[model samples]
Target: MPFQLPDALATSDDKPALSLLRRYYGDAVTSAGAAAGAAFDGWDSTGTRTADVDRFTADDLLAITFLSVRVPPRAAAVLLRDRAAELGDLLAELGPDRDLVGEDEPLTDDCWPGWRLQTALRDIPGIDTTTATKLIARKRPRLRPIWDKVVAKVTGTHKHQWEPVRVALREQHHALHERLVHLHGAAGLSAAVTPLRVFDVIAWREGKDRGW
Candidate 1:
């Protein structure tokens, strides 16, 4: 089935959820951006670029996920030591789809690396759909979207599964990307936060604040 946003979010008169999200985005720009910047500096000191996941130590994983997604220490540690290389390869293969906007295609697991990565990461202990996708988003900010519990609820996605949610995001990527980009600029946010991050924050806030 083709994906669709819930009617409350899509056509609400008050748009309270969206208002809350905009406020959250502004707060994240100043607050989360500062915290993430400091943590990222520490990460870069270890010479671990986003694509160099193979070079990531347990400490690196802990620090990055703490800064970005707040993944639990134990889970981050396990993922760090065990599946770093596999995760890296997935991100490298996914890369950035510059032509994503141009393609007149429906997203499928076979064509979307995010879906494939979510499936592959399922085998890794301590890395569920939320954590796995957040890790990917941290590495490839422009290409991947984070799908925490809040995001899943807001989007009406199936819990504990990521491909359907990812496919939905891929279908809306172009318009959503443009909106996030506009919001980033209009809000006077720093370049440190990417459009995808903003989208995640917005969706998270909607689910969290409005109980979507």
Candidate 2:
């Protein structure tokens, strides 16, 4: 069951998402957060030790900082010490190549591991829901969709986001996914930016416009 995109997502001539992408991530080389996100993904390349599914590096925290979120020393210590193994276990359960648009519906069987990890990350002292999701998305860009307060407000997904976001991406035979890819190229964004991130920015921008 695909999500019926609201009027706010007038995918016709307006192309609000594409415009936002262009405004924020120009040519992928000179935008505000573009360099940071690209740098982070470059560092998190496949086959690297830092790219290991089970653990996070100081670089990961540093990367999110570029996007305006930070994990303080105390929370970082907690993640490194108390949560690494558990997070790794959950990551191992999920497919490395699975994209959000292709996730199984009801989402229970396939997405449960991620949900468990998300819950655990949010439980950390200094990590809120937005920070937790951003951290998870950084590691599994293809598999995890980010949801900050603004994005949640715009999408109206709030505390429950996975199913609705998945449905939106799956809508019209994966129209949103195609739009994201097109916007990435059209906006001249780096390949490092995933489709999920494109959607996140779009929703986030819309939320900001609405003063959320």
Candidate 3:
């Protein structure tokens, strides 16, 4: 069965979801280019640079800053220094294609290990939920969707967002993901951009418009 979007996300005759996705993504891409320059390019295009899942790179840290989040210096040091081995071991639990949309098993069952990793990251000093998720998303763009306040409030998934979002992405045999891919291509986004990211950007932009 297809997952019907909430009224907030439903498309009307005047405002189609596809067009809105394109508009929002376009604005973001433009802003990223202007603000992040090479760092954004490095982050946005997987073809140009493969992310080091086992370690956070300079580009990874710089790129997230463009998206309105920054890893505090102390936290960055902890991630890159004190807990390097621990981070690598945790990230090793996930694979490149471990996308939530393709998943059919319960998220808790299949993704608990990674969830533990996320929790550990969040436990670091100066690293909040948003910053931690963004850092993980940098490493596993397809597997981890970046969660922020605006998107969480708009989607009404503040406390337990990932499982519900996984359900939405997996609905109707991933029809929503298919639609997102279509919109991504239609919007002329980079090949590296995942369907998960397309969904996130669209929801985030819409949330911003609503002043959430």
| Candidate achieving the largest lDDT | 2
Q: Could you tell which candidate, 1 or 2, scores higher by TM-score? A: 2
Supply the TM-score for candidate 2.
0.83
- Could you tell me which 10 consecutive residues in candidate 2 have the lowest summed lDDT? 1-10
Clashes of each: 0, 0, 0
Off by over 4 Å in 2: 1-8, 27-50, 108-111
Cα error, candidate 3, residue 207 (Å): 0.7
lDDT (CA) for every model shown? Answer: 0.54, 0.71, 0.69
Off by over 4 Å in 3: 1-9, 12-15, 27-51, 109-111
Model 2 lDDT vs. the true structure?
A: 0.71
Q: For residues 99-172, could you state the per-residue lDDT of candidate 1 as single tens digits? A: 23333455554657656776776666666776666566555555556666667667666543334434444455
**Candidate rank order under TM-score:** 2, 3, 1
Task: Tell me the tens digit of each residue's lDDT in model 2 across 6-105.
Answer: 3335556546666666565554455445434445444542446445656776767877876678998899988887777777777777557468888756
Cα lDDT for residue 120, candidate 3? 86
Tens-digit lDDT track for model 3 on 4-73? 3534245533245555555644444454222232134236433434546577666677788878888889
Residue 139 lDDT, candidate 1, scale 0-100: 58
